[model samples]
Target: MKIVKAEDFDLRREVEYGSPEQNEAVREIVAQVKQQGDAALLKYTEQFDRVHLTAGQLRVTEEELAAAYQQVEPSFVEAIAAAAANIRAFHSRQKRNSWMDLQPDGSLLGQIIRPLKRVGVYVPGGKAAYPSSVLMNVIPAQVAGVPEIVMVTPPSTGGTEGIDPYILVAAAEAGVSEIYRVGGAQAIAALAYGTESMAPVDKICGPGNIYVALAKREVYGVVDIDSIAGPSEIAVLADDSADPAYVAADLLSQAEHDEMASAILVTPSPAFAEACRAEVQRQLGELPRRGIAEASVRDYGAIILVDSVVEGIDVINRLAPEHFELIVEEPMAYLGLIENAGAIFLGPYSSEPVGDYFAGPNHIIPTNGTARFSSPVDVDDFIKKSSLIYYSKESLLSNGATIMELARREGLEGHARAIEIRLRKEGKAGEAE
Candidate 1:
């Protein structure tokens, strides 16, 4: 790892940027899916995944799930069940109820909250299967009262590295009604447009490769999608009191995700920077994804030594990291200053992985610099709201003329006439004679 002062503009810029090819490819994939539906999906599946899945095989059977459960150990199955309960408990608090209010003037106004009729969740099975992701995606929709939830993953790669049995166990625990043995862009297309076997979903959530991101972009209007996720990243704002080894390990946790991933340490202590750089090397030797982590650190990692912890925090807000860990002496002191982060890990004990698995919070977070405006996945993603309004004769009479005048001012004669017609029906306004 290389150390740079916070004043190094070029290095700072590179750390925050991402490649744009994913966006363009996503546009193309979405179009093909919308136009051809399942046919295009099957073609892509065969090309990308090297497997052919007929419509009937698209939905995983209960018998297959039971076999999957039998393949995993009892202890692992119990852990997934416990994790599901925690996830469900946290998300249930986010449920919104439909409400209506009566006004003094005999008007009724409010909004209705309704769950999406159906949803599709994409779980990546290529590099690793995320059973935790299965829990994170399905539990929220269940909490929102969504009637149907379906899941999809690439067929097992014929190795333990392919799709972990834990992922299947987790999905079953989370109440996913349907599972698919397909993945990549084709799976995303199937979810958005629906094949003969796959039902069309109102919204699609979860994570995948660049092809999947492009596919989701292509099918966005055809079906709602979660934000286009980028490579993983974590920014740690630490001081001299922070542990260099823990910081290095935490940063590498995300760095190992991909070469494009970023892990930055912003601190006031140059000594801390030196120690962390050495610690990264020490830990890299032991990491299973050493090549991936090494490349990520060599290209995008940074040790930004600032003048003060306040300046370190400022740089973090500027980066708008996907995950922010505060390891200062009093980490909570800067909590309010954190304006842009998908999640904040306070104190040394709260590692980023906690939120990824056992923690109650959803792990599907905004990536790149999107934390500036977007938020993490939650129950809100699976629900829709409809605004309600009702007016008494008197309330309409009071506001109708202003509404008509405004509409006419905008050169919308039809809109103005609509209001005028309403008022005339009540004998409160005159028609053009």
Candidate 2:
């Protein structure tokens, strides 16, 4: 890890807009799925996934879902069930009801909240296949009351011909039975533009490779998407009181996710900074994924020297990391000062993986500095809100003139007439009464 002064380090990396060739390839894939429906979906699955399948084989069978339990350990099932209970309980608090406010003049105004009818979650296959992701994406949608939650993953994972048993077990535990075996950009297209075998979902949520990300971008207006997620990131704002070994381990947890992933440490003490830097190198040699983590720390990881803890907080706010750990002696004392972070892990005990796996909070968070304005996936992502408006005759008449004035000032005669017509009829009715 490179060590630099807080003023010298630059956190921004070039945003990934897939290359022209990749974009064009995704566009063509989306277009094919839109045009040929199931045929194109099957064709692309065979070509990309190297697994030939009939349209019937695209959807995972009930027997497969049941047998997946046989492949996974009983302990795995217990852990997932416990995690699901915690996640469900946490997200249940975020559920909202439709509300209407009545006014003194007999007018009604409020919002009508309802869950989306259907949603699609894309879980990547192979090395990226994470059971935790299945729970993170599905449990929230279920909590929001989304009735039909569909899951799609590649037919093969880690050179195996079937979906990972752990993923299947997690999905089953999360109560998602509608599973599909297709993947890549084509799966995204099928989710957005429905094939003969599958129904189109109202929204799609999950993470994928560059092709999947580009495919989501291509079909955005056709259906809602979760986000264009970037590489994973973790930033630790620690002090002399923090353990160097523990901090180094937490940073590597994210760095091992991808080569583009970033792990940064900001501390005021020069000795603490050196200790963490050396510890990261020592631990990096022991990791099984040392090559990937080494490249990540070499290219994107850093240790910044700050004048004080307050100055360190300022630097962290500017970085707006996806995962932030405050490991000072009094981590809570500076909690309110953190302006931007997708998820905050306070103290040494709250490691990032706790939130990633079992800790109740959704792990599908915004990355690439988007934490400044975005949020982690939650119950709200699966629901929609419609504004409610009910104006009484007297209320409409009272506000009609003001409405028309604003409409006309904006040069919209049609909008003004819309109010004028109602006002004229209501006025006549009132006069007769």
Model 2 segments more than 4 A misplaced: 157-160, 428-433
Off by over 4 Å in 1: 9-40, 158-163, 430-433
Deviation in Å, model 2, residue 363 alpha carbon? 0.4
lDDT tens string, model 2, 164-252? 89999999999999999989899999998898998999999999889999999999999999999998999999999999999999999
> After TM-score superposition, what is the CA distance of residue 274 in candidate 2 from its true location, in Å?
1.3
Best by TM-score: 2
lDDT of 1 by residue, 1-433 (tens): 8899988834333332225775665566666766777676666667666667666666677877777788899999888888888888888888888999998889999999999999999999867668899989998998898999999898764421134567778888887758887787778877877767778899999888877777776678888998788889899999999999999999999999888898999999999999999999999999999999999999889899899989888888889889999999988888988898999999999999988888798888998788889999999999999999998887888788888888888999999888888888888755321
Top-lDDT structure, candidate number: 2
RMSD of each: 2.7, 2.1
Error of 2 at 54 (Å): 1.4
* Local error of candidate 1 at residue 233 (angstroms): 0.5
